[model samples]
Target: MIISRACPTCRSSLKLTQKDLFDDRYGSPGKHSVFSCPKCGFGKTIPGLNRQNIGKFYARYYPLSNENPKEM
Candidate 1:
């Protein structure tokens, strides 16, 4: 049962699940995995990276990744 939603930035249909990030270095069973919108190639890493930090990844890890800003 994947929760599907439209990308807020690209408006592409997003159906996210654990299987989508099988070999990811950033996500895990505990962390949330954010997949990309195939149309726009918008790769987002859904946060909650830290146990103590929640609902604040935008200010927390979003900028530190140093990856493509649009993708982050």
Candidate 2:
């Protein structure tokens, strides 16, 4: 069941929508459902994602950068 989230910006009701599951912009893998406030038009990633898997996913899928080779 989809649950509505409260907008942090305006305290309005937010609705979940299908969004790109993986976000690799930061060189870390992320899986999230998109939530946007209908009233204020605010948007953000849904909360309560599995925190435990973040480290593992990042370690495995984070992109390599020559600028910070130590991170690899």
Candidate 3:
């Protein structure tokens, strides 16, 4: 996918690159994309991470961290 977007600070085109997961303690597993600006070298995740799906991912890794662990 062409997940790259224009840089907010420099208004430059972002380049897509493969990046490994930074940390798996809270979340994040497997490979992901890193969008970077060639002009200013600004880098960030292509997917634009958020806590939207964190509940589902966290629940899978830490069963007891859910609101109702006994339900599982």
Candidate 4:
């Protein structure tokens, strides 16, 4: 998970904090958040995904590749 904020202008790193929108009262609540960069004046509002996020972990994008065919 991206736990830190990044400067959109300078591509540097910044600190992050929980925004007001990040309420956990809702069961399995979404990750809607607002973050800002300390180096440059860059901020953003990110509406996070809900329960649908589980699918990403189940699908393995790349499977094991076989050794060189000629070596078999």
Candidate 5:
């Protein structure tokens, strides 16, 4: 099935390029999809995370400590 959405950048028709993508780095649950805008070549992720979820994901996987950034 081909799914389409409006591009967040240019408001163009975004085509579904990839689906069921998983977050292997953080082992986050749920599947995500990628959409690409043919006009602007911009890409976006479907089912974008809310503010709360974004904070959680960053805190769990990406810490802002002064430690070696490359190690992370």
Candidate 6:
């Protein structure tokens, strides 16, 4: 399914440019898309992280001092 969003800057509809983009560095769990507003040239990730997911992503995937950062 194609998902579109409104650009925060121009209030224009953002089109999906890239789909199923994954976080290769952190390996966070989620398939995201890149959306670009044709009017404002603004870009954003579809289904952006909220307070809940932000914390979870950091806690689960983000490496701490004790963990090896290059292991991923």
The digit string of per-residue lDDT tens for model 5 on 1-72 reads 343488878899888899999989777778889989999999888767677788768777777676664697
On a 0 to 100 scale, what is the lDDT of residue 72 in model 2?
A: 61
Which window of ten consecutive residues has the lowest lDDT sum in model 6? 63-72
Relative to the unseen true structure, what is the C-alpha lDDT of residue 46 in candidate 2, on a scale of 0 to 100?
A: 69
lDDT of 1 by residue, 1-72 (tens): 344466768898865544335435433234347766778776665542455554354544345555665686
lDDT of each: 0.55, 0.69, 0.72, 0.53, 0.80, 0.81
Per-residue error (Å), model 5, residue 2: 18
**Ten contiguous residues with the weakest lDDT in model 4:** 55-64
- The lDDT-based order of candidates, best leading, equals 6, 5, 3, 2, 1, 4
Residue 42 CA error for candidate 3 (Å)? 0.2
- Off by more than 4 A, model 4: 1-5, 22-31, 47-72
| Tens-digit lDDT track of model 4 for 24-44 | 443344455666677775776
Residue-level lDDT of model 6, residues 6-64, one tens digit each, is 89998999998999999898887778889998998999987777776786677788757
Top-lDDT structure, candidate number: 6
TM-score for model 1? Answer: 0.37
Which of candidates 4 and 5 is the stronger one according to lDDT? 5
Which ranges of candidate 3 are over 4 A from the true structure? Answer: 1-4, 19-27, 51-72
| Candidate 2 vs 6: which has more lDDT | 6
Error of 3 at 39 (Å): 0.7
- The lDDT, on a scale of 0 to 1, for candidate 4 is 0.53
How do these models rank on TM-score, best leading? Answer: 5, 6, 3, 2, 1, 4
Mind giving the per-residue lDDT tens digits that candidate 3 earns over 1-72? 454499977999988765665656655566667888899988887676457876766667667643686776
For each predicted model, how many residue pairs clash, with residues at least 3 apart or on different chains? 0, 0, 0, 0, 0, 0
TM-score (all chains, Cα) for each model? 0.37, 0.49, 0.49, 0.36, 0.70, 0.65
RMSD of each: 8.4, 5.5, 6.1, 11.1, 6.0, 6.4
- Give the Å error, residue 17, model 2: 1.9
